[model samples]
Target: MTALAVTITHEPARTILTLDGELDMVSSARLTDTIDAALYGGRQHLVVDVSNLTFCDSAGIWALLRAERTVSAAGGTLELANVQGILKRVLDLTGAARAFRIITPGQLTSP
Candidate 1:
């Protein structure tokens, strides 16, 4: 199993959390905690960079949705960047794509 690796980068108006590896049940909590901490730190814009994310299961999707709710409740916004492959398909199929501002790989210079 490839453990999820999260790298955080602070931008002027948004915080970017780049995810690598598998975001499964075993690693979803780390993401939740990171997001909670960022929110607590007064981050109003969050961008999840999933360009290097190799796999994402139901738990991962839940984590993303939960993050959206948390951020929204705090009067913030959440965006998913570098979304492609399975992750994109899953979100589209589940109708969760409409819940987020998705930044496809081709739309950005880098994630």
Candidate 2:
């Protein structure tokens, strides 16, 4: 398992958290930490960039769901930008595809 790193990039009015590496049992906490920080910051609008994520497990899915709920509870919006690979398929199969505003890298150019 690779160490997951979440890079935070501040957007105009939202915070973009770019998650790279593997989100498995070994490194899921890194994701939780970064996402929790974003939520606590009260940014509300979150864009999770998972394009570079190579792998994910159930823990990763749980992390995403927890963050999604947290954002909604705060009356904020959460979106997923650049999700692909197996992670994308799982989200779709689980009917979570509609829960997030999934965007591609090109679509994020508008900021």
Candidate 3:
């Protein structure tokens, strides 16, 4: 199978990591590396734009949780944005929404 693709966009004060394709065990490392780079690279706020995310398994959730911990320990915040569809529902169902900051799609464009 072809490897999944994740696109990252950097903005002032925040970096948007847009996760595309599937986020499974293989792709989890990529997400971790990207989030780490953004968080420690002087970006005070990291936003994960999951608008284009097609699939997310348990590994995906683990990746997010690990990133959340790193960002929290670093005194920074990671905001999850543009999460919809099944992923969004699953997050809410699992109560993971309360673990980290979440921004709706509309809010992402406004600020």
Instruction: Please provide the root mean square deviation of candidate 3 (C-alpha atoms, Å).
Output: 1.5
Instruction: Write down the worst ten-residue block by lDDT for model 1.
Output: 102-111
Which regions of candidate 2 deviate over 4 angstroms?
A: none
Q: Model 1 over residues 15-89: C-alpha lDDT tens digits?
A: 889998889888999899999999999998999999999889999999999999999999999999988899999
- Backbone collision count in every prediction? 0, 0, 0
lDDT tens digits, residues 1-111, model 2? 477888998877888888888877788778777767877877778888888888888888888877788788888888899887788899999997877889888976654
For candidate 3, what is the total of clashing residue pairs? Answer: 0
Displacement of the residue 69 alpha carbon in candidate 2, Å: 0.6
Go through the candidates in order and give each one's C-alpha lDDT: 0.90, 0.82, 0.83
lDDT of 3 by residue, 1-111 (tens): 425676777777677778888887888999888877776678768888888888899888989989898988988889999878998898999999888888887877736
lDDT of 2: 0.82
Error of 1 at 68 (Å): 0.5
- In model 3, the Cα lDDT at residue 78 comes to 90
Record all residue pairs in model 1 with backbone atoms less than 3 Å apart, i.e. clashing: none
